[model samples]
Target: MLKVTPNPPVTEPASITDPTSPYECPDSKKFNEAAERALDYYLGPPTARIMAAPYCPNRLYMTNPKSSNESLLVDASETLGSANVMLNDFAALLEGTHRKTLLGIAQIVMLGELAVNQVLDNLVPTE
Candidate 1:
């Protein structure tokens, strides 16, 4: 008896954007718009996804003495810039730093748990 192999599904490039072709969405041009939104969310304003429109820098930008007291889980403070900048500076410090005195470590852990739950929920939804 011969085993039958299933054919690979074909994706319509006409409906998809070619990575090299620069935002060409054959659909309704919505994909292009969405791609730009995603990029802007990461690279443009409200970078933390927590700030309002004006995007004024928050207290997190200020020096936290806790930084001196305890080692951060991701200690890249020596190399400061946007990438290392926390999701919401204080937000991560509250959650990631091993510093016992810092606020919101519990909250950060809760949020992380919720995010993980969301992923798992997507994979195994209740019937």
Candidate 2:
């Protein structure tokens, strides 16, 4: 029987101290400063910011109630009509439960539209 042998280990001695070294220890302070500067350069705001209350309901709150109410009614009416058309189109394409559900939705939208129309008629009382 022949015996197997492993390769010998190799070792390199460390370099002695030199006055002029190519690499030096990294400066964490300088790195942090550079990172902060880079972040500021890329992420800084374009314009001066005025900080206000985060939860400001008055920002878009309607000033005139009566005029806004009328406009809202008209918009609701239009939205309901568009919804009815879409629902009808979908109902035509669907079957069974889906068809029935869509038809139900269409009926509800129509009822809402009629209610809005009645409210408008009562509010304006036009001949």
* Most accurate candidate by lDDT: 2
Any idea how many clashes model 1 has?
0
Candidate 1 lDDT over residue span 19-102, tens digit each:
665545555477778888899888886646765556566787676656632233123322322322333455445544543433
Poorest lDDT segment (10 consecutive residues) of candidate 2: 13-22
Candidate whose TM-score is highest:
2
* Candidate lDDT values, in order: 0.53, 0.76
lDDT of 1: 0.53
The residue ranges of model 1 lying beyond 4 angstroms of the native Cα positions read: 1-103
